[model samples]
Target: MSYKILAVNPGSTSTKIAVYEDEKELFSESIVHSDEELKKYQKVTDEFDMRKETILNSMNKHGVKEKDLSAVVGRGGQLVNIHAGGYLVTQDMKEKLVDASTIEHASNLGALIADAIAAPLGIPSYIYDAVGSDEMKDIAKITGMPEIVRESFCHVLNSKAMARKVAAKAGKSYQEMNFIVAHLGGGISVSAHERGRIVDAIPSDGGPFSPERSGSIPLNYIVDMCYSGKYCKREMTKKITGMGGIKAYLGTSSCLEVEKMIEAGNTQAKEIFEAEAYQIAKGIGELSPVLKGKIDAIILTGGVAHSKMLTDWITDYVSFIAPVVVMPGENELESLAAGALRILKGEEQADPYKK
Candidate 1:
């Protein structure tokens, strides 16, 4: 029996919703929220009602009926670290998402909005492959400093989806192969997927610098700058995440613009762009040992992976380790839908959310 599924993925300024009839998409829409409209909300959770209403209205406009939806799936948000898969949205999960003490991210609203819409219909609402999916071994969490330990925080949803896609194309199950997946976009994360689980990863902040993030920096330099009295804690944080990398050097976050500059004979732009690629290849190489050099493939994905020039450069460096498959774009909506479909078809079980 075919099941109709609704997938909700909330971003910083938009809520992306899609309807899928089994595996085929019926309709999808991105409900963008302007800065002026979003300013009224003190926290990301406060925009819940508005996002949910817009999603429902979009569904109605698209000729989708609420009663026909077999299940609702949402992009999982930041919660206590859990293994990868679909989880039934529970009150325990919702509470953690809205808890002021936890980190505030736009993604935190995904499950909340989905639950609000699905609960009334008496249908299951699930969060799939949450951003905080942490399955790293304890040994992988070690750091040089005893005060710090690495945590798993990468683009789990898209990364896992791409991995599974590659596995299927190779006529093998995900659990039968190992992969090193790099998600390159505004932020970048390189993970070592051993068999089915992510055994280790270089989270966005600790990996190569991306369009906006500074990635890993020298600890000595960071400490010196922190106490330099040049910037406050928040400002420093912004410098590392929001205003660093390509934007810091070239005054723009767009890789396309940098490519344009290269074509226009800007030597600095070319150098910086190459440097980013160099760092990415290095990051991929770092994960090779984790998989013990037995990787089946190295997959490059996410928005920035669309650039042939960038992907080509990275391939040149790391192609020796394994074949580089360039699969661009973050297919997040489809990933959510597929996860829900798997649960609905009894191909996989939906894990319960626990605090």
Candidate 2:
């Protein structure tokens, strides 16, 4: 049986919507929201209705009716940690998405909006490979300091999707392959895929620096900076996750712009760009032990993977672990669509979202 599935992914500045018939995508649209436009909303959740309306407008423009949909799947938001795969949105899930105590992210709006759209039609709303998916082994959670334990908060959606893609290309089951996946975009996430499970990962905020994120800085200096009081709490947070890394050094987040400057003989741009790639390779190498040095493949993906110069720098460092497979761009929309189709086709079961 064929199913019309709508996949919605909410980013920091855009809502990406896609309609699919099983594995085939019918239409996709990225509804971008400028900073100036989003400033009106006090919180990310406040834009729920606005984003939903935008999605409806796009769907209407594309001639896709709500009643025609079989299932709606969204990018999992800031829910509690759970295993990988599709989850049916229940009342519990909705409450958690809107909980004030939990972290607020644009993706959290995905399930809320999906539920609203699917409820009236009595169709199921599901979330797949949410940002909060946690599957690390117990030992992996331990940090040198007992007070702070490591959390699994990397690009689980894109990393797992690319892992499955490369595994298929190699004629091997994802559950049987040991792979290292580096998702380098505005942020970077390097993880080890032990078979189908992600055993360990260096999340964007805690790993190598990216185009805009200041991955891991020295602990003592960070503490000293915090005490120095040059920045407030919010500004300090932004420094680590949003305005740091190459953006801090070059004053722009676009890798292409940085590359252009590098081509024009900008020594600072050239060195900073190479340093980002070097750090990415270092993060990938750190995961070698997680897979016991028997990695089947090293997969490079996400937006920055499109840069041959950057990917080459990373490949040069980690090619010894396994064959480097470059799978540029994020496949999150397809992954969400496939997860819904899997449940609809009885190939996979949708798990309940428990608080």
Candidate 3:
């Protein structure tokens, strides 16, 4: 029997679908959704229905239908302490699917799409390496109050990229070595991988902020800002992400734009830009102890990791502990697809999907 695996990713304005047959990609398309139609959705949960319908319609245009799918996989939303791996779809994952408090990530609908369409075709719906999947152990969950770990983190897509780049150079599989991979992307996440499993991590909560994320901040600063009446708590809280970090100061998120000013000899731009990269480097440095110098490589992966100046700076400073391997850009889609194969082959166990 020919098993067709469908990978769906929901973006804010579009839903991307990739059909794969085992390791081979058959077709890929991005279905665009208009903002006006999306705005009509009273709840974020409606996006699941909207996107499902959109994908169904798009598949029809190509003469395919929901029944053709054998296995459905997709990007998942954030959930606490989820271990990375393929997971069997269940009702538990569905509840969080509709929860709109964390993020309205279009990718969240991947699992839902799989859920709705897979049964009719006798296919299983699965989530591949979702953002919620945290391979980190209990120790990494610290945020403060002995219970809280004042830390930050990125995601699997970023860490795996770094791990692969470094592992190849190290002449070993990423699974064979213990490493601390820090993903400096829209949001930063660092993980301590013991052999193959992530044993610890610094979550973005109460940790350092990033260019797109206010990584972590002390409550006192937040309380002070609130009591001082200079900033609104609700507004400031939002500022810790979307408008915080580089966007807060520069009104732009593109590192390319910042580097242009640096090249033109803008001192202030140079300082702030350099400082941001430095903070990421500094974050990587903190993870050194977690690996206890047994760290094989310092893997930098993300859109930001491509910065020549930033990579060089990290290499210069972090070289003493381990060599740096930089894998710029994100191949999250491919990674997600690959993970599904791992699960199907029984190479990895099916984990419980959060959302």
Candidate 2 lDDT, 1-355, residue by residue in tens? 7999999999999999999998899999999999998999999999999999999999999999999999999999977668888899999999988898879899999999999999999999999988778889999999999999888888999999889888888898789899899998988998998979988989998889999899999899899989996989899999997899999999999999998999999999999999998899999989899888999999999988999989999999989889999999988899899888989999889988878
Q: Assess every candidate by TM-score.
A: 0.98, 0.98, 0.86
> On residues 275-305, what C-alpha lDDT tens digit does candidate 3 reach at each position?
7667666777787787777987777777788
Worst 10 residues of 1 by lDDT: 74-83
Candidate 2: misplaced stretches above 4 Å? none
Candidate 1 lDDT (Cα, whole model)? 0.93
RMSD of 2: 1.0
Per-residue CA lDDT of model 1 for 158-275, tens digit only, reads: 9999999999999999999999999999999999999899989998889799999999998899999999999999999998999999999999999999999999999999999999
Ranking by TM-score: 1, 2, 3
Question: Given candidate 1, what's the lDDT at residue 32?
Answer: 93
lDDT of each: 0.93, 0.91, 0.71
Per-candidate clash tally: 0, 0, 21
